[model samples]
Target: MGKMKNGLTGGFSGKVGTLVGSSVKGQNILRNAPKKSSKNPTAGQLSHRQKFTLVSSFLRPLNGLIKRHFGSAQKLKSKVNLALAYHLKEAVNQVEDGFVVNLSKVVISKGILQTIFVDTVAIVNKELTLTWSANLVFGSVNKTDVLTVVIYQKATESMFILEQVAERGAGECKVQLPASFEDTGYGIWIFLTDVGLVECSTSVFLGEF
Candidate 1:
């Protein structure tokens, strides 16, 4: 209604009833708070939202694994969500050619496959045992590659990881499930990591054993 100096008294410089005005660096600035859009989202927006929902559904179950192996729960979740979204976006075109890919089978890193190919999952003495085919070419370059096994219990939201240096002839390993996780169902994910990226297998469920 009236121009007033903005001082400790909290006075305004211009009309304050409907639209407010303020001065910045001696320039008068007038604005109103923006309102949310009311229009329906475009088809592209809907598709993007669908993809995110699908990816998040797959990842939500892995929260325990992310927190346990990757650390910084919140940070890992955001990183995985973004990375998976990009991966799916790029793979959508490939799917048209019948090259359907499972998100769980995709690894975040690009690298030569080095880990043993898991053949079967078995239970031994209250533990999950994984058997694999050897990859002799894994470290022929003499680059250090690490083998990691991750067991995730979707039902109980529990996860465990076993890490070992990739050896030329090793073929089997076991992961002891925590006693607290007894009688809980689990999903197994194995990875082969070199100095660069990690390549992992799609999770396999071994019902409570």
Candidate 2:
């Protein structure tokens, strides 16, 4: 065997000196070519990417809400976009045309709404109360800001058993549920929005209540 200046030498069938070369399907190929990493992405990173993409896509239609809820100024709107992109939790996912955010499992400690957590949900006499950790609203939340509540019936495959939008403050709000869905198993989701009622939280789930 004679080694060339580049170190590749001709040899027997499918053998090129130390390297292996072959013709497959009438195409010449190298067997031991430096391969690329197949599993380059960690599970955590992949999951986060998926959540971010889903949230971004869902929020596209609610740009007005983002502007109104966060602020009207262009600088404030930029902050809103960054906050939403960075503060999202892994519990976000798309369901048909809507989304489900499991609030109990979500944690948003980044961007403007730092330490924002949904702590508890209480249902009494068909009225629902949701309590959360004090939000650090960075001049984005206004008096017109509201919370949007949605109840989904998993058994009936209905995306919304009941939907309500109500005025809210920074901490919590209580709303009455329709009597019809009281006995049915339903999932609760809530998102915060401005007066425009378009911008919103990721629609965090409050479990069956």
Candidate 3:
């Protein structure tokens, strides 16, 4: 049942007869309702579903990070949706019969703020240290920008995200590995965000750890 709001002339939400009424970008939209059928999915359709599942499952854990930092949300697309669309198209590789996400090609954040350059990444004992300098081909970044680190363990699909770990000008930060993270490879990425400016920089893929 479609309820009338903003007067009878206003937009509505729900189904009436064979037509469905909805709102998009504050605009009232009416379209033919989908017909429910018991048809079996074709091979191509199934393949597409499999691909979507693969990407969605991998990125779901980073929903909070991506939804707030990926990019500006469009009329009908949220930032999380934008991220999914990007990885689905750019980061996936077609395997024998399914798809797998390319970890190196994965991007967690993207925006206008220029990020600091990471000079070196080294591991001492169980502490992972990340160091950077004021050297950028583009230009220097804001010293007040907060740093964010994302560590992904492919073997267990476990992730560690550290936000506001240090200031851009701080030069370095350390992350102590958890015992469960032992004997595993890490895909690490970093980005900087200017809290006052409400802007974030593209994440730097710092190779495997």
lDDT per residue (tens digit) for residues 1-209 in model 1:
74767564654566665666776545566676355699999977787776666555555645444423331224324445544655566534334523333534433332344445567778666676676666566434333445666565556555565555344256666667667665555556555554443333223333233
State residue 135's C-alpha deviation in candidate 1, in Å: 6.0
Task: Give the winner by lDDT.
Answer: 3
> Which residue pairs show backbone clashes in model 1?
none
* Candidate 2 residue lDDT tens string, 1-209: 32233244532235445566654434445565454588789977776677777666544544443444443334323645654654474556557754555435432211222123578877778787777755555565554455666555545534432333445455767777666545466666566654554554454556675
Worst 10 residues of 2 by lDDT: 107-116
Off by over 4 Å in 3: 1-32, 123-126, 135-140, 178-180
In Å, residue 19's CA in model 2 sits off its true spot by 56
Error of 2 at 142 (Å): 3.5
Q: State residue 98's C-alpha deviation in candidate 2, in Å.
A: 21
Ten-residue region with minimum lDDT total, candidate 1: 67-76
List lDDT for all candidates, in order: 0.52, 0.52, 0.84
Task: Judge candidate 3 at residue 38 and give its lDDT.
Answer: 97
User: Residue 178 in candidate 1 has what lDDT?
Assistant: 62
RMSD of each: 10.8, 15.5, 2.9
TM-score of 2: 0.40
